[model samples]
Target: MIALPPELLGQLGTGLWHVFAVFLRVSAVVTLLPAFGERSIPVRVKLAVAVAFTLIVLPAVPSPQSNPGLLPLARLVGTEVLIGMVLGIGLRLFVLALQTAGSIAAQSTSLSQLLGGAAADPAPALGMFLTLAGLALAVLMGLHIRVAEFLIHSYAMFPMGQTLSAPDLSQWGVRQIAHSFGLAFALATPFVIASLIYNLALGVINRAMPQLMVAFVGAPAITFAGLFLLFAGAPLILSIWADALFSFTLNPLDSGR
Candidate 1:
């Protein structure tokens, strides 16, 4: 049997502890990340992803204090988990923005009930489509690389074993939520405008020909228009959403974005 020296054993333990500490944070973040964190993804795959991120982030971050006491270790766990959740929730808001935009667009185009249960979550068909497309686009654009950097940068903003200022965090959360709603509204603007025009023209036609059943005549027209607009405007809408998402990833606290 090969007997390892006490010094080497101590070093090994500390190193493992450091990795565990980092994993705690990484796993929390991965639970709510965009493409990689979707509900459809397997739990094992997510665990592997968290490990991969921990390895990627390990070298960049400073090592945790070696051999902490039970109380200190528990404190560290809580702190790291909370920080990870805050960062993860921030990123998740962008996904919420897409979902919100999808709901608005779907309702505006009168397509809300079509395939509403397509996704794991109970959302409108358009919402499901946009969410899936946005996730794919985000992945294609090297979301993993940006997320690694984001995780590394998080260490700077939220240092090890320190509690964040609750007031500041709360304020920041509110800002992110407000921005998400605004972004959702902006993305759905085209559909909303089209709905408005359809309503006005329908009103005029109804007035002009009281004998004609305008609802029956216009239902198909509005549905066709919605489909056409989705096909035509999707590219632009996704582009705008992607830009906002990337911007948020780059700087979560940027209120102006």
Candidate 2:
């Protein structure tokens, strides 16, 4: 191979730092996305995914201004990391919608207490279902393509070295939290209605026969009915949820900075 000229070598060295910044930014987002972010995924797999994303994205990302000094390089890296984190966290909020729905469904069905133990994530049974559903839907929807598009658009909205404002972060967080609650309620509505009718009927039985152990009789019946309702309603709910998640993940203005 022919040797690169000294001037060309200098230019290459200067551009390398910019490439590193892009890699950091892209990797950060990949490391936080659902399937890749989960603790179940091996670190090696996550790293590989991140690396692949970085390579693909680097060409599209605008190069950072060349900074010869170490401090500027450090600052560039930090800015990229921050941008990545914000993007990741924003997308992660959609997952919370599922968790919230699951928790609501469990509580409404009176199955919350019966759940074996606290999940590592400290979610209720409904929340667990929601999480699994959302994750599965994300995987099925081809998350990698959506995420790449999101990242590309993000660069246009919140380019490198531009720190997100605190107020912007606060607003985004609050909006996401509210959306999570709303999505959960929407997902659990059918179950909630079924649960209400079941409980009201159980209450009537208790009043009619005070001597009978209504709680024992009602619990098993409700559990079986709830399972059936879940199976029947799950497909529609998951479909709606997948559509919502796709919209949220792809929304260019989601960052709202």
Candidate 3:
């Protein structure tokens, strides 16, 4: 059996503790991250991904307090977990924005009930499409690297083991949420406007041609227009969403974005 010296043992224990603390934070983030945290993914796979991320980030995190006792370490773990949750929730807003946009667009275009089973969550069909597209685009654009950098940058804004400021965090959370909703509306605006025009024109036609079955004629017309609008507008909508997500990833603290 190999025997370790006292000083080496202490150092090894501290190192392990630091890694474990980081693991807690990473694990919390992985539980709610966009692609990795999808409902379709197994919890075991998520745990492995979190551990892998912790290993990658462990070397970058600062060391733990000197000779910390059990209680302090436990509190530290709790703090790290909270921080991870906060950050994960903040980033999750991007996906929420996409979902919101999809729901709005789908409703506007009267496609809300079609393909409703496509999403992991119970959302409208357009929401599912936008979420899937946005997530796929993010992954294609190297979301994992950006997420790692976001985590590393978070340590600077919020050192581990420190109490997170409630007021500031709340304000930021609210602002981010409002911005997310704005993004959703912005993405879906084109569809909404098109819907308004179609409805207005249909109303005029129905008034002028009351003898004709306008409801039957307009339903197919609106549906066809919705499909065509989606075909033409999806790329642009996804591109705008991706830009906002990248901006948020690169600079979460920048409210100007």
> Candidate 3, overall lDDT?
0.86
Please give, for residues 1-257, the per-residue lDDT of candidate 3 as tens digits. Answer: 99999999999988987888788888888888989998888989999999888988888999878668889978888888999998888778889999999888888888889988765567887788788888999899998998898788778887889888899788888899999999999999988998899889888998998898877888887788888888899999999988888788778877524
lDDT (0-100) at residue 71 of candidate 2? 79
Q: How would you order the candidates by TM-score, starting with the best? A: 1, 3, 2
- Lowest summed lDDT across 10 adjacent residues in model 3 is found at 248-257
Tens digits of lDDT, candidate 1, 111-206: 999998877778998898889899999899889999999989888878888888999888898888998899999999989999999999999999
Instruction: Please write out the lDDT profile of model 2 over residues 91-163, one tens digit for every residue.
Output: 7777777777777788777777656366775677767776787688778889888887777777888888787
How accurate locally is residue 189 in candidate 2, as Cα lDDT from 0 to 100? 92
Cα TM-score per model: 0.97, 0.88, 0.94
lDDT of each: 0.90, 0.78, 0.86
Q: After superposition, how far is residue 188 of candidate 1 from its true place, in Å?
A: 0.5
Which candidate leads in lDDT? 1
In candidate 3 the C-alpha lDDT for residue 203 amounts to: 89
Instruction: Give the poorly placed runs of model 3, Cα more than 4 Å off.
Output: none
RMSD of 1: 1.2
Show pairs that collide, candidate 3.
none
